[model samples]
Target: MTFACGKRLFALIMSPFYFFQSRRRRLKRQKWRKRLRRALFPFLLSLPPTVWGNVNDFALIEGVRIQPPAAAVLSPGTSQPNHPSPIHPLPPLELTAGRVLLQRYGCTTCHQFGKSTPAPTPGPALDAIAHKVSPTWLAAWLEDPFTYLPASRMPRVVLTPTERREIAAFLLGLSPGWRLPSRPDLPPDPYRGSDLFDALRCQQCHRVGGEGGLRGPALDRLGTKTSRRWLYAFLKAPHIAQPGTPSHSFHLVDQDALDLCEFLVRRAPSGAELPDDFTFSEQDTILAHRGLRIAIERGCFQCHAVRSLRGPSLPMPAAASTADSWLDHHRATGETILQFHFLPTARLAMHRALQDTTSIPNPVALPSDFWKLPIPPQGSTPEAYSPENRDLAPEACASCHVRQWEEWRNSRHARSLSPGLLGQLVDEENPGFIQHCLTCHAPLSEQYRTVTDGDFTPDHGITCAGCHVRAHRYFGPAKPDRRLTASRFTGGQHGDAVRTPAFRQSEFCAPCHQSDLAGLAFDGKLLQNTHGEWAASPHSAREETCQSCHMPDGQHFMTGIHDQVTVSRALDLEIDWKLSPETRHLRATVRIHNRGAGHHVPTYVTPAIFVKVALGDERGGVIDGTLQTRIVQRRIQLFENRELFDTRIPAGGAWLFEFASQLPAHAQLLTVVVEVDPDHFYRSFFEQYPSDSVQSASLIQQAHAQILDSPYILFVRTITLE
Candidate 1:
């Protein structure tokens, strides 16, 4: 702990770098020359004992190998009342006495059975203690350890049997699962952690599992050595002046902290090797320090911070000093530094240097964005659409938006030509329909051959890469390069190569949804008009694009209660419900409070949402028939000559519907189910007749009818409907 010792320690830390460099420089003078034997021996001996174990497997890691339990100093059974004596008792048993003694002496500092790890190598691991020592010896050791073991390191204590027993029972009952009594809850989505990682660009220096730059530790599994709370605190605020310095205090937000902790804990080695607090040799420490310096010298900290700057600005370098002031300010205060940045070349150089220093990885030049494998430009007129020329899609997007892809897998856009509503129109019944569908549905480049017969590829329908990647430009379906449109086509590649830019913007989704295909016709007119509807709305006039409303806050999954709230606010009707009691039966009423739905609650479509009441007991035993009633029951006609069964109440008009059902006399609860059908549709007039020529009329009708019969339910409240 002296300044000299600190400097020596720091020197030891820097030795690994110097050792390798010294050896290399000496090698240039003499072929395969070894170091001066004595000098090299001390340097080698200077290594941390743990590193020696790492290299030779001979040196033992201190405090790791199990030692004999603290010698049996106290008589058995007297430690606590409930802890029966393993041997004859010499004193009275009590738990409170042990508790008092422990609290009075601050024994909890190093021996936390729960969430804290006070100091490394402070004492023995006490995760499960009944298996480690006898209750009698534990009590005696707590009271006066020097009594039995002359060289006992533990201090003597004075406490009654009650106080001693209390502490003893607490310690003896310790289990690995012990944690603080109160712990905060975590959010469902750990997306914040992923965002933090990207914001910090941790991969720039730390190589995790052979990937990423190796300027820092290969934290393939870090959770094994650290706690989640510690990591979370460290990510945001690094311990600059503390003993650990900048290594262990990178503070993280709650979610990111938890998620990263989960990720690391999952990476812990399968089998335990060394004890948690085992000390390392001086050599290992030196190597680590040298490695850290190398990382810094190569500017690995530019993008990846072992200690990130969370405040305002990037960390500034140490200021130049005058000639006479080298030792003037030994205690000079360092300015708070924010962050660092590295150029592509510098990053690559550091990567190479670290690999050479560690003998871990051979540097290989990779594309700037490794997620999307780069392709070279080829000489061609119309951009060739070969698999080789196309850019591989970036996987980084998936890292942030995994749940969105899962939902899109079965969407209409994903399966535009696979026997769904759109695909039915492209079957052999109409051979030319495939070409027409592909214009908007598949959105492929013109270089690909046109469809002449029934055909499909994994890339046939709207896929992630197809929509996101395009030639020359990104976002929206721009016209293909004109060079390929010539009559005598030269199948050469052009500058227009598939590039991913749409993933960053809303305009990317507009081309297919907004414009009409060249050939398709619906009843001698245009077909689907989602884009048209969106554009014509007031939102479009106000510069609100399709994604703004549908995908609130740029989330991958573009559907939620917010959309319902937005649309519901625009319309006048607000559907609210409650239950009424009547004898043993209960009446559930749905009251529509019209606020602002431009049309009606169930307008332009037929949706069946009703109030259903059911009586059940604690064991979920049904006792009565379910009573069901619908607001727009049995398709009643209203205004505008529309199939008014699904009527639109005036902007401010209200409607009330009710259902009554008997409850079990012994029932404590009755369930009232109220739902909203987001995907409801009225049978079009054409669909009501057999003459309608829409290709999937029957299938569409079947899907529509099933939905009408059983719509998606919404809120379910179990009031004392009994």
Candidate 2:
């Protein structure tokens, strides 16, 4: 064979091998690109759409974008589709179904919601019901609201036929002299009204025939519930017809309002008739008086506003009923329109209401026999000593423990039965209610008037005997020195003290400072959860207890949210600012850290911490529209029985409040103020009890004034700028 022929054969075989190697390399490059694209896909999507102009035109796979021609390009400053602003993210406002129920049922009248004051009473004022609706409609509604409007928040109220008639008569008789004016000009136009309803988007907030938003009441039975004239008046000017109504006036022409009213009223189910004209008569006077009695008995005034009826004065006939009985009645009979039986916590709240007791549960766990007075020491006569000595009053204890008594005297515990509490209990005739309050406020048996026959003085609030004295023996924490024994103490007249290590544990304080009832919790958090909060914190692992901080060094002064020094110590605040010369704007950031405390800075719902920032002129006055405020606290809607927001900083957690605004031409300084309100909830609660509405008006007024005086500035800082 020739040399040239052999060379040509080898070259052909090598050419095929080289082609396979090139193909493998190309395939490897494609795999790498695919992996890289996958890694960048999420990061690209997270970027603003403007980052990749006309994002919709491109199909993004992994990190690569494949776009077709004709895709629009978005340039800087060009208008874009409306999207949520991303400058700063805010916590979402949480509203629960439970809260809606509470508001609908008029529970907010007595209970508050969030940091704001309690909202106006939910139920309509009954003073003008006679002039507003037909007597037949009123009776039917009072008897069974669900039958008329299936989505009604008004509870069934368990009224009998006679009771319903009487209640209707009483309400109708409220405005006996006034009558609804006839409006003959407005005529029926159901078809036009239906069109107007759709144009107005009425279903956005209201429901008709069980389809629409739940913001407003269902209009399914409006025809049977209200007259044509009344409905037209309401549609024309909702605010004027029913002040504070959530319904808004559409500024419609008279004819349009008439049409809309007709359309809404026509939504009634088949066979339903329109409400007829109503006239009040002298015979209603007798029925009204009886109705008033039943209304008071049934706690109707608790939620509904009636000008003729004052706050409930008569004691509840079932005041002696136990919590279980109250719960059972609500569960079995369905007296509550909301059907509280399904919610154990709600049922418990109803029980508390029936008992006229505060929603706060007993804090401390006491023995069954804890309230019983101890038997006098052997041979000690019942009348041998003064009442103070016999009862082991605080004054007697102060004689021996001067420092501790002095500290405690200035503490909140000493004023547990302050004017606020006393005012509520002053007109309260239910002994059970009073007793439940005294269980924590004035725990000693001797302090209870019912038990001691007025022997106890109200001034001696939480007496020393309440915590230390039991069975005529002194009880307290064990001595720090393990070597010391009870035998070492000399028994003079008072006898040797009984010591236990349990007093040093946090559990000892759990009874009063913690609520163990799951039903009482909102958002899975107890109303008073200091102990639980501490348990979840790192301090608990380090063996820190409530006494370690609140009662440091065995001090009787239990300093808490009210003490400026203590609160300041628990929190760490920092303020930083940066001035942008380009935009002539100043950005300031204020950070608050719950650094020292084992739990939340303000551990209970009662206290609120506010951080306020604003621009100030040379005179130190805040500039208009330049102020910003942030609150750090657990905000609850008492009536709604739900937590609206919990901005409270947990242990070791930090909350940031950022402010960015253009520097005003005359701005000279930046000021920040931090204020603490120890009685925020109490202030709102006290303000709700109007002088004319409640029996203990004077006391409530005094309480309101006292609570108003409780807020104090915690921190203030000012920075100067040229």
Candidate 3:
């Protein structure tokens, strides 16, 4: 054979391998694109996309049609996989791949999925979801996405009970025949179930043997507490149990769900055999009925009927009354029955209902935190209560520790009750979190834990009474310290002062400063790790503590990052500025050393230290292009469940920021400023709260005051070149 003929034969043999290689590369690229979109969502949050024309075509968004940027090129038809979830229904084989690809891409804000329109929400297309899953399952999934799956991509959307039921009713009405699933008839075995749960690593989120995380609730009594029908259906597909959970769905065998459901049912705790006897007063009965009437008129009847309206929502217009009414109904999963912050119009109507003399509630008021003792979020934490005047409350301590008390009175520690702080709540409704704040601030206010809106937080803060008082005794730094005082109200009381290990160590601040946010993990690291940082710092080896620098002489003013003086004292800054006129280059080498701080300079996520080097005029006006900024923060981008970046100076360490900028030949003034935005992160979220909200508005003003009062400005330097 000729040489050309032999070459042709070789080409033919390798053609098949080349075809498969190209296909694999395309799939790999597609997978990376999906992961990148999710990871950088937060960066794009503030930069929502503008209209763009599709590649030589147009797409529909909502009702208006938009032409994507001409440069945009969409995937060529359904040849692309939609990050295929193994169990989700497959697209119709008859439909062209192009048609399916359009449906796959929903939002072009970052990643465009569909060719024509925007999705109403995240997750699978649900317009015909009724045909795929039962309406009951749909409702359950929408209510609590987590109960069903641990790694679901759905974002939790807060909805009223009525809205959830309305949407569910609408969906269930669509298709009736395709609901529910086919599972095993085998009876549930808790023993086998327990083994499966362990194998599946369910303990990562839930606690069973008292060794799991706090992200999910304890499930030892889950079976006894819930309906078996819901459990079976939920196990099959978590979406049927809860809709917007962050948990991931699994491709489990049908029998897996059946066995798990049965085990859960069998493991449930026994119920109280009988309902406890109770009676209602004429006043209480009338109040409940009035509240029920209001809710019904407000369209709450769709989901709750005449029963419980106790949900984990904002307060109603007359939240004190409506929130306490109705106890007979079962709240659906993921349904917020207690969140009562009604809309403005609803508040107006509720007010009118109350004003009417003839209007009185007919529903029974449920037992709630409004009139019940609170369960401490971290179990029982009892503090000392002193009836005698010997107690060193801030006011009483002012007598002997006059200077320290006065300093604390004007410090950030004295002003902990701001709307920004009050608004720091769990994304999921957690009653325990409500009391968590008071655990450190008020420490002993029962009203703080019980009353949501009506009670006033005592202005004690981390007061003199915080550390010294425990039950009926007082704690101090030394031995043989005791005091007794005669009480005007109840004869006399006794208080013995004993040394406490916490007084001399970091543990004193641990209860409040330490936090484990499993949900706020960034690359498998907790976002809030102040206590941990301190424990690992060089300061720990020498037995130095948070109190060492902040309380040099037992000063009550906890000189924190919020105080400019305190901040200046914590770190040292040295800047080297230069002007290379020949090359038109302006250079700076800023060294920030953690001089006194025991941990990261700022210590927390809230404060951000900003270092800016730029060309400026004699009047302090900045020239463009010569500016470079470095931010030192904890990178608590919890919204994305990931950290973008973090650069902070650790104890006995230094951060060197090198900046070189091309300068205009005539530019002679150079300025280097290092300041701190104490409430940088706080302000980011605080802006989301409306000023018209009485509570938030007050807090907004107070936070402004705190930011103003916080420590800032390491130094300002201006260097002039001839």
Tens digit of per-residue lDDT, candidate 2, span 1-722: 11111112222222322233244465564454345434444443454333333212343242245542442232112344323222221111111222222323333333332233322343577776765677778876776766776546566676887787777777767862344445558566989989888888889987876699988877777767677776777776676566667557458777787778778777768976434434457865767776765775554654576654432222332264653553454245332222233355444433343333211111123332332222112223222122333556677665435567778888888888776777655644334335445656676545655333534454567768777766554456665442123122111123233455556777666545554332145667656667778888988889988888888888988988998898888888899998887877999999998888988878888889989999999999999999999998898865455799999989889989999999988898999899999998787566653222253677678778877767899889999975
Give per-residue lDDT, candidate 3, residue 128.
Answer: 36
Which scores better on lDDT, 1 or 2? 2
**Model 3 ranges off by over 4 Å:** 1-387, 390-393, 396-404, 422-431, 445-453, 479-494, 516-520, 577-584, 617-621, 690-693, 696-698, 701-711
Candidate 1 per-residue lDDT, tens place, 40-59, comes to 33443454332121011121
Candidate 3 lDDT, 1-722, residue by residue in tens: 11111112222332332233244465664454335433432222222122110111332222234433333211111123123212222212111111211121110111222132222222233333434444444555656654554344443334565555554554333332334555467665667776787778887887775688788767775543455655666666665544544544465566676667677656544542322222234334333333333433332222221111222322212233542341112122222232234344333433332222121111121111110111122222112211223344576554334466677887666655444555432121323334434444455443354335545543545565555543323345532221211110000012122333346667555445543222123576644456677888888888988888778767767767766777787788888877675887767788989977887877766788999888876666788777888898876544344567778888889999997877775577878889888778755444443332355467666666655655467788888855
Model 1 regions lying over 4 Å from their true place: 1-412, 421-429, 436-440, 445-455, 458-460, 476-545, 559-588, 591-626, 631-644, 647-671, 675-712
Q: What is the overall TM-score of model 3 with all chains considered together?
A: 0.43
The better candidate by TM-score, 2 or 3, is 2
Task: Candidate 2: give the clashing pairs.
Answer: 37-62, 37-63, 38-62, 155-337, 363-511, 363-512, 364-511, 364-512
What are the per-model C-alpha RMSD values against the true structure? Answer: 33.9, 32.2, 32.6
Instruction: For candidate 3, give the lDDT.
Output: 0.48
Superposed by TM-score, candidate 2 places the C-alpha of residue 104 at a distance from the truth, in angstroms, of 66
